[model samples]
Target: MYIRKKKNTSGSISIQIIKKIKGKSKVIESIGCSKDPDKIERLLKKAHKRIKELEPTLFDSVKQEEQKLKFLPISNEQVIPIGDELFFGAIFDRIFNKKTIFQSVYKANDKHELFKALVISRILYPGSKLYLSDYLFYFKKKEISDEAIYRLVDSLYKDEVKQRIEEAVYKDTLAKVGGKIAVCFYDVTTLFFESESEDDLRRIGFSKEGKLARPQIQLGLFTTLQGYPLSYEVYHGKKYEGHTLLEALLNFQKKFKLKNKPIVVADRGMLNDANIAFLENNGYKYILGAKIKMLPSGIKDKIINLTFIDDNVTHEINIHKTITYKQDKQKHSLDISQRLILTYSSQRAKKDKYLREKALDKLKAKIEYSTNLTKNDLKLSHYAKYLDIVDDCKVEFRLNHNKVLQDSKLDGLKGYLTNDTTLSHKDIIEHYQNLWHIEKAFRISKTDLQIRPIHHRLEHRIKAHILISFVAYAIYKEFEIKTREIKKEYQISYKILRDLIKHVFAIKFDDGEIFPIKLSEVQQKFYDALHS
Candidate 1:
């Protein structure tokens, strides 16, 4: 039998095999006219088997003339793990483009290497500088020292290197977003130290994590609307959240040389009269958080009775009223002329009412059945505010229901203040809602990056340590943005991305060649999306 090709009228050729019989060829079999090699080989095997069945003598000659294929033995005894950190490093460098940026800033490549290793390690396995040597072995087995890491942190703390790095990162982000930034989100979070002692910079203060007994340092993070960090600051743990934004705002403004004044957006805890005045005096506009009950009695009454049309509403909240301040007013020693955007959320109200009622029930139960209270119970001034003790034969406690009702007035209400009246109330609310961007940055830093429970003792080391976390966060955000841009349908979050990067280990053999472990479909998507 011999293979043959027949060109049809459609100009597509069909492949076939024919038997040479009676001086005329007869078609023995026809394979589809496709260019697939595997399919052709499979069809060829079928044709040969048919021929062999007809002529067993042909198989003897075919076997004698067949070429032998060689197979190599693979040794599994020399397997080694090489994590996908190389891919992470490659992506980090691709986004940062630190080739010349670092050379110019650090005066040499060693510090640059140390910085790269530290930041990548921070993203991979965030820890103290002492662990730098251990993490470096994952990268290239570079012999980094505790001293090298300390010097790196010291360089960041003493000099203004962190700002330079941030500028580079922020510039890259602006390029990603087409170079227009009119609004920024700001928020403050506390990072606690393990030690009980407090330094000037690390003081005991109100921690968001409720670690007031632990000395914490406050961090004010500034990010764009998409949660990419533009700049960040470290303050004494006890510093006021309201005061932390000014330094970062002014520094970021001057550093970027912004063309338009950015409308600052922050949560309610970061709002105060002095901060509003400072922001206004600097010719900056703001969308600061306001407590509904903290407003003047007149304003509060108007808000409580105001009727809202369903013109502009979101999922959980409704914009009820927009009041622009034409004349300055003074209340609680705060003189401000700003627009107040009132919003009410049914969901928030429900949550607030539920939480308040639950808290009230808990407090009432404790007062009734918690036995005779000790000084610790008295020290909890909030719980003690509603309690009345009877010292007659035995101690009895009662809760003041009026105080509970007084707090119910502002259950589901939130207020935002802005100096820019040109923006509609809807726009103001929209901007303030994105403050979750900064909130998320703080969460990533605290939870994933492990910026808290700081192990450093000296102030410079602490500052340097935080600076490393900042750099790591910038890289993490940029990488995250790229992954989203390329493949949003997969929903590769930070944790999933980290796990993907962590699991793709290169398996090195006893020979010089190295092979990467087999990746699943999800892992392949991550690799392609980033590389793409």
Candidate 2:
């Protein structure tokens, strides 16, 4: 049946709902002439509903769906969560199975599903593999031994399986969010171990979180400008972070088969003269954070003298013309094409001076009390250069006010370096500023993925543990993309989203039909958003 419009004698119009049966055209219903099209559409809907009610057999599906549009009244409603071990896992599995190519990369085996269960368990509650099975067995009633998980992770380390997974994830991310792998933001972080002694992989290094004297492993993470996980590497605890950049990036460039000259953004720690040359040689462009305070005396004087333009929020940042420098280093000596950008903020200056003075005050107390001064105590005091130490005879010190005043000149300014001279200073500044994407990614990995406190001593197992979290993180990223930004409207925190998936249980009655319990209003909104 369809709508029909007819013209009358007075040039008036009439609309009717018509049904064609075999060869006959019959008027199912008719409405008098109306100027409004919306009124006619409402009449059409009412006519269709009446027809469906009169002929229920022809519209059973529609009737049932209509009933679902409102709540389905159940005489005997029982919410049974026992059947699915975790509805949450089922939701995670959908994201996991759809977004990643893990299954195709590795052959399916007897314990393949169990391997996935470990990943889901980690997302649900991150903890040791040794105790995961116990909780799964008693609380979850899903039994997979910890040794099986150990052996599975052991297999991941064999034959470059972890590398294969990383490769597969890279391919999947590109396919999902299509473009060449461009604009990568890189950063390094340290993860400490709980063990008392140090090993080769987990030697004591400078901890990012200040877990001093603890055995820690450094993790170098790479991500897109949008903070999606791309690739990561684990290095020896005491290994210089500046040295890891060349290897990690070269391996990534080689393995992922990224095309020529993708832009790499990194912080100052990753911006050494050698690494810069390596990047330039490899046909990769980089926008790197620069230690302006540590710059050569000549360049420092030049940069701090530039006039800042803080007129508009969009145009407030100042950018200088391209700055070229001569590097007469032992290994890397060439006329480098570089740009130095200086950014200033009144707020940052206050914070910077406040922190420097705070550290100086702490050093004053330490010099008075610390009888046994060591290298570390000296390192903690940033103003130690200004101190007149007469500790050979007795612990005594005097502060050099001149040096303190000199250091205050560079309080508000920050610097960045980029080799891509083609881009405007604004573009380079914007790209460098997006380094926070990788920073946020590290925060999620460390806090949400709990990629720290190496619970496993075996190197392969440790690698596998990171891989599992990596895959979980990929799923999380896809989820965030789908959900977009609706926290204000939905208040859908991870806990809420997890609970919504976890508590989505069903009841199966005698007729062998499953009925998911009614969702709360907010839950329904989230469900719609997830699917939408």
Candidate 3:
């Protein structure tokens, strides 16, 4: 048998192992095909290896026996496989190249390659910069030192580079969404650091992850209704979540120069007088969560009395209120009309009741077991209102049945405040439901991407780390969209797809020859989906 290199019409070389039988050439095994000269040479070598395995001569058999005997003393643990590259990394690298918004900011060179590698690693294997060199060497077969990575990160934190990236991603996303954004979603999350020290940017605050002792920075993200990220901002950890909305929104609008104002949607945390006035005074429509219990007694009573025939029906109440806000050291008031859309769900009601009962049970246990209950304990517990403390020379605690009854009356009811009168109440509710998309984005970033517990001490490096995670999330969303489009019956999750890609790797020889392992049926389907 001999190795054969055949030229295909597509201007590529196909290597195969051929044998001669009865004066006719028969293809024994088709090794592979490639367009590059180096890959073609590697394929030729693989074909030769295939020929030796198929028809072994006396010398080849002796050589195989010698190789087996040479490694006889080595145990399985010592026989480590080296020089294997992650095929999934290559797939994601291709995806990153196609969706990257940094080409205009950074040139195509080692720095750009390192940036791409960092973003891809954030998705596949998130860790510290110290491991970056080893990660790149294993995945891309390239050498990038830790100091080079730190330098690139510092450069990435520049205001010019950050603005350019945001603009590019915004334009790209706008094009993807058909050049118009009628509605958008905004949300904020906290990313804590691993150290106990505090700086200008990193300070201790109310952490959503319950890491109150660790210093954290707040991240505000703006995304399309479908959860495609448009822009992100890193704020000081101690800033109020509500205060971040206006800055992020104003900056995004000013930078993008949007002609039409998109309706902003956020949860109750962003419902503040200043935000409402800013959205209204600037001619921007908004959908914000309303604190039903905190409303005026007259309005609250009216809402609690309204009866719902079924879950399908919704009740709408018109509210007119004057909001006072401060700007330029001047106080101003604006009177605005909004529709408070209230919906009832049995599932939601059950969840609310379960949570309240759980909290009450814990409060009761604490009161019964502990003899000395300090006022600080009551101050820290949110369920303190459900208990009445009597200080008559001795403190006594009792359950407030009236407060629990009042809360039960409002169970399962959710309110959404909107200024858009054109859309129907059902449309408003449906639009508000899309807020879950942003929540899911945060979940993926915190868990799958591992974006928190930042180790960088410098402010610029922390910002750079967040920027990498932002870009990584964009690519992840694209992958999710593609996988959904490819498989209509059932969608493949990111975790499953990642595992499959992990198994599809290539072996690299000392002479720069690569032999890709055969792909499973499902793996091939997924691979084709990405390549296609």
The top-ranked prediction according to lDDT is 3
Quality of model 1 by C-alpha lDDT: 0.71
Candidate 1 clashes between residue pairs 3 or more apart in a chain or in different chains: none
**TM agreement with the true structure for every prediction:** 0.73, 0.78, 0.76
Task: List pairs with backbone clashes in candidate 2.
Answer: none
**Which candidate ranks first by TM-score, i.e. highest?**
2
Stretches of candidate 1 exceeding 4 Å from the true structure: 1-86, 95-107, 308-336, 358-407, 484-499, 503-519
What does candidate 2 score on TM?
0.78
- Compared with the true structure, what per-residue lDDT tens digits does model 1 show for residues 1-532? 7767676786655777788899999987776674565766676676667766655586676755541111134444334334435556775565555453444654557777777878888887777665566677655656766666677667766455666677777787787667887788888888888899977997988778988699988888888898887778788988778887778887788888888777788888867656665686688888878777667766766676665444344222222333332224643333446677777677788888998777767766776677766545655554455565576344356666775665676677777877786987788888988987787788888887888789889988887787778878887776676677545777656667666666665545444667666777777776776667
- Give lDDT for model 3: 0.80
RMSD of each: 8.6, 6.9, 10.8
Better of 1 and 3 by lDDT: 3
In terms of TM-score, how similar is model 1 to the real structure? 0.73
